[model samples]
Target: MKLYEMRDRQSFGFSAENPSGSKGGGTRGGDCEKLRPCIDIQPGETVTLCETQGPGMITHMWFTGYIGHSFILRAYWDGLEEPSVEAPVSAFFGCAYDENFADRDGNYPVLNSAMVLVAPGRGYNCYWEMPFHKSCKITMENRGAQAQTLFYMISGWHGAIPENSGYFHAAYRQEHPVQKGRSYTVIDGIKGKGCFVGLSLAAGMNGHNTCWVEGEAKMYLDGDRYPTMNYTGTEDYFGGAYAFGNDVYQHRYQTFSGLYTGLYAILGDTSDTYNHQKRFLLYRWHVKDPVYFDSDFRMVLDNLGWTGPRYDDYTTVAYWYLESPAPTPVKLPEDGEMVMK
Candidate 1:
């Protein structure tokens, strides 16, 4: 169908105003009435955001309020016992580490991309189309020490799901001070057929080095011992070269956010801890160039630099789509392990 084309389909949405997503829902509320604008989740509590029968595609999602690692986000498709998607709320949207959210001056990071949009004031939005044949479920777990307020909306269209449509999945991984002389595994233990679509990399140099972006991205597909694909360097993989093309004006390495790739967040000696090191947040979406695999896949990045292997603190969120519902390989770490100071 072209723009302005017509099709027989029904639209629905879930939110605090209308938890059921029923037809003519939220009609009971009035202008500025704000009868039910949000929900609060206490510590150690899990809230089901959306749970409904599906033969539909989830088109968009918007979330705010305490939008960081304190909350865990998970999604299940086709009534699977295991969630196909799991990760911290922040990393799923390309924001990782505590210092990357904002500075003392209140300058929020911005990422204008084809799949995600992170606006000021902690607005986290995703445009990934998640299709389910039988049912779909999305939940949030508050792992923080205090209660958290969540404002959200899940919207989509009811239609016939294609037989070959893949289910979306995302997982988070964090390693403080990567092992010396060893590469950090971005993602592994991937089984079945799917395409790796997006990646979020948050890094801080634990040891001295000219830069931490010297690592090379390697991908092993279909049980290959060696990598079949490689990104020359970390910067090159993010569409930058020679330390992200130095910005003479600011007297620092340039940072930018484009449609599919970006170095969006930068923290310089402002962290509560790790003050001696600098941290950077970057993202890449394989929207135009997806990594398709039939059997299995794995991706790793070497922590190398000018001198030699440079151990660093690294974290990431890997996103993909598979033909069937499957849980991510990486398990969510404990709260103490996920925190970044």
Candidate 2:
């Protein structure tokens, strides 16, 4: 965030050609053309992209592939046993539902934000400053049944971190049908000091034909009985209102992406297949106004105003920063549990 302040650091990069990220990475083959630009990730395989001792920060990351939904991304900081960053590849880059309604030109959806960006035709990019004190390691796992080709780059600077710098973390959760009585917990059990940076949310109606986005967002900090911070409506939390720019039954679901808020993906809408089920992708980044907690933190979304056999499915990814690079207990959904019909 210190744009004007220059700091001493060593620049490094990791890619298929430079898997180790050494000084002369791309020259292993010496003057060879198209030398190891992509990697084939087989089923049930994990690839270690970066593993370096660091008092450093990851400035940027880029990945171009069709393995978002099938591939899992995990990052460990400060030599932790568990990863601080854990989510599906596409979901972490602001597209929770992998398949999006194509644009007018029949291309992929786009998400252009301050921290994450998804270019046309499946290019995923991130600009979050991930810092670690002792060490950092990032890995990608292909859990799908088929093989996937991936071209990626991880770049950063090795330097001294500020004492106040917090470590980056991400966790993914999903609720199909949202459960009649239970609300959707975006993230919970974070028992430490940190600030909630933002979240990516995807919703799909399971059966009902009525508008299903009347839920509201709530934030519970420091062991509160009720939420100290709450929003008027769920769409309002993501800077959208009146059912995400269109009535669910009548019009095409519009898409948008901004610096801090976005409704970027809409799948199988009236404009697409005209099904009763309406799926959406949305996000809101609290870059300017993060929800800080000193002791503990949790947040949830209320599934208000509905009583029927039909309900909505919700997929959420919570991004935040912790005080240091320590592992917290996190249970992620298994591959079988997240299969979209």
Q: Tell me, by TM-score, which candidate is best.
A: 1
Candidate 2 ranges with C-alpha deviation above 4 Å? 1-6, 28-32, 100-106, 247-253, 271-276, 305-310
Candidate 1 per-residue lDDT over residues 93-163, each given as its tens digit: 88887436664334787877878888988788999889998899999999999998999999998878788
What digit string (tens of lDDT, one per residue) describes model 2 on residues 142-221?
Answer: 98898999999999989888878899999888888788657788998887898999999888776655556667789999
lDDT of each: 0.85, 0.81
By summed lDDT, the worst window of 10 consecutive residues in model 2 runs over 302-311
What is candidate 1's CA lDDT for residue 319?
91
* Clash pairs, model 2 backbone: none
Give TM per candidate: 0.94, 0.91
Estimate the overall C-alpha local distance difference test score of candidate 2. 0.81
